[model samples]
Target: MLGTICRFWRDQRGIALILVTIMLPAIIGFALLAIDMSRANNLHNDVQKGADAFAIAAAAELDGAPDAWTRAERAMENLVDNTTRFSNSGLVTLASAGSVTVNPGASSCRSRGNISWCFLKSLPASDSSPITSSNYATTQAETLFVQVTVTPESFSSIFPASFLGGSNGLTVGATAVAGSPGAVVCDMVPVFICNPFPGQSLYEVANSGQFYKKSLKLVVGSTSWGPGNFGFLRPSDGHGYGETDLATDIAIGRVPECVSARRIYTQTGNLTTKVKAAFNTRFDIYANGGGFPSKSDPRWPPAPNVRKGFQYASNGNGQGSGSQNPCNMELATDATRYHQLTRDTSFTGQIGNGGWDYTGYAAANQMTSALTHFGSSYNNTTNPPSRYDLYHWENTHDSNGNVVPVGDPNSLVHTQSVGGETGVPACASTVGDEDRRLIYAAVVDCSDSYVQSQLNGQSGAPPAIGFASLFLTEAVTGDEVMAEIVDIAGSRGRGTMENFVRDDVQLYR
Candidate 1:
């Protein structure tokens, strides 16, 4: 028996089982801790996603309206319905700051979760300070951003922390900041028009027909232009907009870069001569040189209704040789034959009294009366249909007065003139381009000190109060760009903005 006992004491057969039994409790404890940690991590991710979503939704409504904060709070309460996957899986409740008039830190809403938010004029260094109601109103236009913070979610951990002398609960918090980075307008022409009615907003004036349908001469001036003067703009794109590039943009309608409607970079030097050839391209007049595209190039096609005064040149003047394309050369001036729409008679320096030769124009173009063209709504004898109104009607209808599909080729409304010049475009058959005659321009408040300085050749980026859509009535004659301000760009509810103002929101942190 003594010999057997000695052998068993030294035996190692069950030693492995004994070791595993001793370490089993520790292994289970570690596994439980890891599971709890993973749950906490998952909860954190969900809360973070929720915060981001909440911030974005709320920020979209802070559009500088008097009721912006109120709208933001409503959006937050109604739009968000985030749920947590871990940590009891309850509906995430967000605390509301009651009314916009309520004190900054006094949130009347509180339940399962809590939320705190603040309006910021700019991105804050830290999210500790919140904006007051009065302060927000004072700086409403500047307060274009919002910061949001969610209270840490606290829940009981499955792992028994008693084993490690710790509490059996975990907490996770999240923060997000979101708002509009202002609005950006895209595909604008490289030109700026001085606001005609500086006393009132552009939208109000435009909607009220203060400038619409009235002819205005956009003159080219390097320095010290009067109240109604208009000029070119320098593209903010660092790719360098030379005379040639400027000419190309004038013809093609937009530069590669989109400029801010709030601020416009005025062209410093005289850009008058280079653009004449480019502007003539829309009227089916292509120059032989100056980097202008050839007549056959599809990219630089003319407007379908290129009804300029001069006809195709009978004698080439050594410029246009081919009979097939005698239209390339500029015909000699004939006061009797050359047909330019007569300017409005009651004219000031650059502005017209909205009374142009509508009767003669209708007779010349063979267009129907405003009553026949636009129906009974616009048959007022006092206010005749604008040239822009006629242009649209002419494009949509064919020679036989039948409705033609937008892309389909249609016969000219009137027979070609004896000199070969006509309203119909010979270079391009289709009028598919986006209103080739409608040019978008920034409307700057020339009365503003900065804008006045800019006009006087000072180095300053003047803020554009709005953008206007000017219809190119005639080709650029000398340094004057003649047009009628048919309407202002963008929606006219609040004010006229750029043609394409992209308003969006994003998460900052």
Candidate 2:
């Protein structure tokens, strides 16, 4: 028996079973540890997704409104409903700080839900770094970004705690930061006007009817412009853009550069003659000479509606003989039927009151009934809708394109014509960027000492107070841009100007 036992011990046959028995526990333990690690990784991924979704939702509502933070919090709580799987709990819904005050420096957190977050006007260096007082946003306008932190999810691992000499529970967490990308505006017009109402905030002035229907005569000069005065903007490249370049940009909408919403640089020079000549192209009036595009060129097509009060000579008025250029004849004074609009009485300098010649203009255009459509809002003598308002009304209110006294068979559909040319475009068959008559210009508060100091030769960028949508009332004469402020950039009263703004949001971390 001893000899047989010694032979068996020396033998390798069936010895593998003993080795397997000894290593089986350790192998199973490693397998369980791997399963636990996989579960933790999956939980982390889910938590990260939840954080990202919540942050994006919150960032979308930071549109400079008064209750932006409150709205952001509400959006985060109500919008996202992420549930995590692969945890010990089987399925766990992500927690949120449901009801918490948004204190500036301190994070808004809730222990019950176990979520923490904060608003930031700017960004931090790293996603893991804590938000501090210097970077936190206190007001709605400053609340441009949001940071979200999900509470750690604890789950028991399948592995035995005593085997690994550690706790069986594993924890996973995630964080995300989202906000609006820097306000980069593309295809912006290279013109800026001083804020007309410096006394009131941009929101207040936009909402108030005081700016509506008001006429502004924008002039070009190297001198310092006050409120209502207008000037040229330097492209972001900082090149010395001359009149030729300015004319091309104004006429064809060939933008020089994209600009930042926070600030803009100014161009110094008197771009009067070229500016006027180029601006008139929108009115279907190309100059016979002076390098202006001919009427036949489709690239510089006129607006669909060009009803400036003036007559032109078919023979290029001694310029390009027999060329039929519309810019041949100078626009007649208001005394003549072919007249430019007179300024409003309420404002001084370049800014006009809402009081424009609505009655006389309507009568001349045979749209008197359009004014009556306002019904009690039309005073006939006072408080009449501006020509810009009437222009849009005429465009949409008439489907068949009839003018005034709609149902009447005698009322002419082709009633809007002045100086032998109809309101309808005659230059080109197709028009591009149909808002040709509309100019989206930056409104800067040049009255500010800092802004004033930056004018003329200075290189400093002056902040734009707001963007104003001005309608070209008539063909530009000399250096003056005869326009009416129809709408401005803001939440209060955004009309057609909303089309120009290109705000986008993205994840910072």
Candidate 3:
């Protein structure tokens, strides 16, 4: 028996089997832990991706509306609730568990009072306090930042680790900031128009008809230095190069002030030459009753009747064979002509009465009537009436049958007393010079102290308020250009917040 025991102890064949049996449970436990770790990592990545998508979607609607916060939160929740993915051997669902914070006018750093300096990289030392959930809301109109935290629904690890004091739950979070980093405007005009409705939103401005009925007086020659003056912009250092250069720069959207140094020049000579050059750069004029011929370049002929020196006459009496007077016809009355005019590249996707509002057209006619037939009886009976009043002619009654006075006119133009030669003349009377009728003008906030100071060449200029498409109904006479504000750029719809001129949205952090 002793000899048999000695031989068995020396044997190594079964020893390997014994060791394998002893280590099998540990190996299986380690494999399970590795798989759980990979699932956790994948969950973290997927949650981050959802957070990023949610932030971008919500950022687009942060246009300073009263319900911006509500919309953003809803967007984040919808994204999380709808996303699902496979993890380990089973599927894992993702959802927003904690609060979704939206910080508007609040930067990734601290407030700098300007949109350009609201990012983390451009922040100054004085404004370097870290942004916290506690103090994120702000009234400044600069940047928008959002933070989202996510927790996966009750995930159980394959291997329980109560003995090793490990938890099975996991949570992840992400943050993003987005805002306009200045706009890159293509074919932007160099002219700047002072905002007529100060301390009001773009929506209010549009609803009030001030956006369509008013004409901006171009600051020229020796106009008084005030808010509504029109002037040439010196976008570069020193005085700007003369007329031709200015037009070329404006056509190509090369105004340096649009990006950095923007200065307005009011005392320059050759104002007519500069304005004409700018207008011609955008339009192709046909003189003496000529019609447009098809060309390779589609952007030519910015407006209808852009050609000058043509007399209005009935069909067979005038140059073209049309029902009404095609030469000097009112575009609003003639639908066919209006459609043809809107086919121009500039009028694509524009707003109002087929991209040209009736309010502006009526205002133009009123200006013409004021100049042509001054002190005539205000005719409220005509279909397209000849009067400065904007109120509907039908009698309006209050609670009692007494005819109530039409409340105050929505626009300043309507309220102005109509008499004398109030109409502004065409930019040029000569043939092929009517292209100035449609000029793009920047609508700037004169109410902002910074903008006002900057206009006078003071230090620290605020960004321009926005841009508008102005229809130069008539020419520049003395110092005024009788133009109707047709459309304000960057306004998504009739009642939305107006974005800054040529501004684009970008992710900062």
Candidate 4:
């Protein structure tokens, strides 16, 4: 049969040669078609990956995911004809009207389904798991698990099939599930204290909420006087001096304790206090809550009689002040509010571990020993207390295994160390302890505090470089409020992975 077809083609006498010639190329062409198909398959696979990445990114709210998908879709949208929705540039542009259509799982968890997809929500402030993490639900019941599905119809390379038929596009699908490592919920942030110093101890016993010192008329400086043991605690779980340090006075070294000491919060001459009940109602949405700030909770106005922040505080541009201004308290934004978050209820009843400044007390004791350094009259009791610099300290466990040492800010010497308090067992060891400085610590509750005999006792001391005061921002649920002590030198503080410490720390005995 093969010879008959070839013989007729050479003779050119029969129509068989023309049919044979045509069929010959057709057969060869079909084989080439298979080869091209293989190439197209490879292209299809590459495009699929791009499509998958794009789909997942679009489904989530990653920083630039939407725009990224736009550029990618532009590169491949035309290959599959104009019918590809995934390849639609309109859904990923500056004016994108795209919304993720979540096909909920059987139990409301998208993870249960085959097609899942997603993206990360912009910084969530709650102690909840990130929407992107797989263990989001395990961390908190508030976490919703959902599978995302996307159809990037533009990924198909239909043009290659034009030889056989015409363009016929393809569609791709993908999904993702959110989760967390463990249930987390600690919202009690202790930002301010009766005595604000880098290194000092406090006889801390309660896990009471931290008080507002600067915002109100309260104490900020720690004293190196008074009697009684002291205790200490920090939000990061770092332990410190947990001994009696005078009733409420902190000291750098031994000294004739003050006749009476206090932390000032107790003398409520003229301090401000908003009803927690009223403030708690901030979560309640107003009846007309439909502008840019969407409301997720129930609606209720300030009950007329309940009262809100001073009047309707307006925080214009956050440059000015408003009692209820969203700009001022951005930390409480509805989407991923960080302020109200606290550790899980399971751990709420507990206290926080305290930390100490290794060099604080060491330097204080050393200063007390000298009475005067480089020629100066040290008198911590009343007038001229010699100025000194306290710098450097290493972790040394206190009697209670509290690894904290109180030291003055900078290397400024304490008046007792430089003026008076000279001899004490702790002082002797601290003075000679070359690697560290002395520290003073004390504890006071809501209204307990002590101050320098004069607000500016040792004026010569260098100012605390950064924020001299601390204020605790209430924790919210669902996401974490990233706290970093990013000093110019990059000093790493205690309490977390890499570089995050709770803004406020609670302690339990």
Candidate 5:
């Protein structure tokens, strides 16, 4: 019995070595797996971060795209480009790797009265598609939560595929989102830099208008404000409140103290030849009591004054009430009228044997209250270049630095009377030059579907408002972006996508 026990003990001794040998390999395998798995997890985290960064860049670009598909497409290209750009920033700038793209659609003219940013990223394939998660089906969302990803492929810590096989590469992703209670202010500023002023139409915007729907504007002098009675408003945005008080106000609100509009003198000179000649020939003349007692010219339209020229014409929005485009029409026929002629030595330089071939000018002999204030102007030596160049700052000042009125009617100016003198009417449009004060107003060419309705409460309602309203103005550009992505997984993993972290958390629109 003792011998047998001894042999058993010896066998037990070898049992320890055997167990060690067997368990060691298993332990080693597990250890290797844990090490590799940890590495992969770390890499995945890195990729997720990279993806988040790229995705945001893509979405931002898409937001400016003209259409949904375009936004998606641009998102893809932008993501790739951002990758390169960030990569170029050096390895330190971007600590990891992953890709991003957007799936888009479902939102349009969001500011027209909608919530959510217009274009946002969607998913793997198309910009946007039906998606379901957390026992809930997402019917439609303007934008998707952000997508961030991590791929073992970007993991340098792992060498070869290890025991897992294939290539040591793996991919993971996560998505995130940011919300912007965007105001129209985003797209309208670059269009017009307004100049703020104390008086006139532009100053009224902070007081009214739907610019919050599109943008904001500043006023005159806020741009260039010495002495001028008018400022116009409207963006080629069709915010058509030209000369309307609100229009001018909104424009100034947009960009105050802006020196000028983005301008290029592409077209030189005045109105078209046909229009000019027509104005000259049909020019009307009236005799105030100062010139003749109770003599009126039936050929002319109702004259606000006996010896002055203010032109009026039909505005073809032919469908609306009082759809008249009014202006002080200066006719070439009135070029040689008595009280209006440039006579400064510089006049020779200004007219160069030529003259402003436009409407009548008179006022020197009219009584204080006779018919209306009629006044003539001469080439101002105070501001030589502008003597014949139409109204400008220099011409607005007197040789004595007083606020000088348009002496003799040079260019046709809209006007009203105060003292014995008549003040010029407000301008009816934004300077239309990038370097000038930007004006913004909502105006349709009269053919707008809801023209009457949309402008119901607007100033200058044909005749009801009694006068054209004014507002600030500016210019804006149009832009579009699109993308598609794909994902494939075999089995036994959590969604296998860091980019689509489905149910762990609720997603935002």
Candidate 6:
């Protein structure tokens, strides 16, 4: 028996089988761990991608929408709850198993969600802060910054805990920060006008719902600064710009940043030629269409009514009422019939009862006629197309004695018949018409001190309170260029910071 035992102990025939049995569980455990690790990595990458997408989407609405924060949260939730992947060769569903946090003007990451997963929380404020990335630290009220964090719940590993030190659960997270650094407007007109309404920003005016009711007459040649005064802008050197360069700038939509930064002054010279060129460029009037004469048309010149400038009598007669007057006589010809068709009407039902002078009423009437003609010619489907509606008047009483404005639900201006006729004609859509004007004049704050600063170039360029789109109401004369305030472009209380006409969204961290 002893001899048999010794021989068996020495035998190595089945020793290989024992070794295989001992190492098999450890090998299987390692393979399972690798598979779990791969799954965790994939989940990490997917969550990171979701966070990035959500942050960017949220950043876009920060300026325009009232419910920007809510919208952003929803976007993140949607992505996390919908993504799915495979685990252990079997499909595993992924949900919003983590919390999401939002910090609008966050200086540093702090506890925001239930899960201790804050975005950039460990980063010191000095080294990594949202303000550092955002150039406008002073305008924090208008600027918006966002942070998002995604932490998935622990996922069960396929590896058996008994073999591998109970490493059965895996959790991963990702974070991102996005910001909207305010707006930089391109294609702005060089002219600046003092804000007529003091102590109230354009945003305040818009919010008060009174913007549409106010009829402001901007005088182009006036030197006295007041609520309704306007003037042509000159370069820093006080010299007038070339007409061609000015027109080209309007067409291309922006002046050089360096030039725009310099102070602008009221033009001293007669601006008749420059005004006509600018107006023609905006309306494409020199180009052909709408029963109007093209630049190529030979019959264009004898009829001064066909020109885009202020429609004044060449003989120096303001109203041109006399039969011999060129303005009054030009309307008789067929080529000038469009001009005749646009004459203002009165409540007595008499046509041509109104004078075509430079008065505010004349300007308003001229604008209406031009818009109507343009709409009839260019717009195929809509009558009095929205682009032509430039006037917004105060509220009017209804037939039932209740207050009502035309297009009440969407009306921006109140319209009432004054002296048996409406001062401003109604356009199909006021919102659409507001953006039609090609010339935009900046509204500067005209408060006593601010005005002085602007005049002396001490305050740099005067802070633009708002912008007004100009609609030529009358043809250009020697020194007189008449236009109506068709639309106002600006926000209330948007001081110092550039207006948010356009926005750019991006990831800061």
Models sorted by lDDT, best on top: 2, 1, 6, 3, 5, 4
TM-score of each: 0.68, 0.72, 0.51, 0.26, 0.27, 0.46
The stretch of ten residues in a row with the least summed lDDT in candidate 3 is 111-120
Better of 1 and 4 by TM-score: 1
* Model 3: per-residue Cα lDDT at residue 63: 43
Q: Write the per-residue lDDT of candidate 6 for residues 375-437, one digit (tens) a residue.
A: 234321222222223232211222233444543532222222121122222211112122223
Q: How many backbone clashes does candidate 2 have?
A: 0
Clashes of 5: 119
Model 3: number of backbone collisions = 7
Clash number for each model: 0, 0, 7, 109, 119, 9
Predict model 3's lDDT versus the native: 0.42
Candidate 2 per-residue lDDT, tens place, 117-184, comes to 77788876786776666777766665778878888888888888866588877678888889964345
Whole-model lDDT, model 6: 0.42
The local distance difference test score of model 4 is: 0.25
The candidate maximizing lDDT is 2
Backbone clash pairs for candidate 6 read 187-253, 203-491, 203-492, 309-475, 309-476, 310-474, 310-475, 310-476, 311-475
Index of the highest-TM-score prediction = 2
lDDT scores of the candidates, listed in order: 0.65, 0.68, 0.42, 0.25, 0.27, 0.42
Q: Name the regions of candidate 1 deviating beyond 4 angstroms.
A: 1-50, 57-96, 99-146, 179-181, 202-214, 221-228, 237-241, 288-299, 311-356, 369-381, 405-409, 412-421, 427-434, 454-458, 466-468, 486-501
State the displacement of the C-alpha of residue 1, model 5, in Å, after optimal TM-score superposition. Answer: 42
RMSD of 3: 13.9
* Candidate number that wins on lDDT, 1 or 4: 1
Quote the lDDT for 345 in model 1.
62
